[model samples]
Target: MAAMIGGAKPADAGAIAALNRAAFGGEDEVGIVERLRGDGLVAVELVAEQGGAIIGHILLSWLPTIMDGRAMKALALAQMAVQPGHQKQGIGGGLIAAALDQARAVGAEAVIVLGHPDYYPRFGFSAALAGNLASPFSGEAFMALELVPGALAGRQGSVSYPAAFGL
Candidate 1:
């Protein structure tokens, strides 16, 4: 059956964790997701379903923008996973696309990701845009995408992950 991308249902949590485990071969992301869920840090969550079964999950959580101990608002892309059998079949890409649309619709200024340097830029995420920003995951993997034109321009600060991230 063709996969459908949609907002996650409460019942999908178990399947989401399973997909994360299968995709990443670890429980770290699942634990983080649980923590973020409990802490209300999840700004967006998308899931892919095929044959009435969940197969992929993606989340965008809120991250504080910290400059000299002051806090602002931002979003962070986290814990994206597609089931092992579904990898590279466009499910992950679709989930990202849908999430970005929602983010822009919600007036998110920018979105950050600590993800594959190669894989994420296609979605308009740029390490250059995030260059001056400080974070534990800085380097090629740390990237930002402007939902508003030049959202990160002249904005230099560290990303403050919520307690759920253990940062």
Candidate 2:
């Protein structure tokens, strides 16, 4: 909560990469972030900064989806990360809250995420909402949240993440 939450600028990519690397203990997520940026798939990017240093990041990318062969675009929340030292300090939650506000402001319909079942629902993501969607990951870990009520109503099909996701 001590950190200032703001939109991530292009110049913060290096610091964001380092933060993701430390948070996830690998470079895969960092690579994903870079690729998303390079491919112009990112819809929203947010950061948590303190002491003039970037300590956390959250990115929402455009996800192309089909429901019964019908196409509509949605947002995907990916690689929400906080520096190891900043874990458990509410930075991740703050970033998510800010990202959701931005996403909603931009008239996004819904957002999907593959994350901890318990951790994400607190932010309105629900496994039941993602039930009919097919993905490479487990259903329990895949979830969705509607920015506007009934956004996902009666929809069922697969999500095609931007090519940058390497899916």
Candidate 3:
């Protein structure tokens, strides 16, 4: 059977961290996940499991965005990774789909990500949509997706991500 994507449990932290390290070839992602969890900033986290082992992971965290003088509730797709051996099998895409769905279900108005210019647009993320929002990371790699239509229609604003991001 294929791997199944589901909400991560507290017990899954160790496995998720390990997978992040393995998939990213470093500890940056692991540390980010830990800090996010420690700071109580994680809004949604999911894992892909098969044969009782986690092979993929994705996380969304609370992001504070102010647009047109009003605060809007948003989420950030902080990190996503799939085990090296599973990279091309669509597991990562599944994790993204599930994460976005969970983000919407939790009432996030929009979600932001700094990722591949070519890869993220397929998921409806658009740099043009994020053009009005200012962040440390900009240009094509930084994109936004609105879970609620017209949620991000604003003249200009800035996003303040949690301290866990170290930005």
What are the lDDT figures for the candidates, one per model? Answer: 0.86, 0.87, 0.91
Residue-wise C-alpha lDDT for candidate 2, range 16-87, written one tens digit per residue: 988888889988899899999999888899999999999989999988876667675679999799888778
Clashes of 1: 0
lDDT of 3 by residue, 1-167 (tens): 69999999999988988898888888888888999999999999999999999999999999999878889989999899999898889998999999998998999999999999999999999999999998898999999999999989999988997889876
Best first by TM-score, ranked: 3, 2, 1
What TM-score would candidate 2 get against the native? 0.94
Clashes of 3: 0
Model 3 alpha-carbon miss at residue 102, Å: 1.0
* Per-prediction TM-score: 0.93, 0.94, 0.97
- Rank candidates by lDDT, best first: 3, 2, 1
Off by over 4 Å in 3: none
| Candidate closer to the true structure by TM-score (higher is better), 1 or 2 | 2
Worst 10 residues of 2 by lDDT: 65-74
RMSD of each: 1.8, 1.4, 0.9
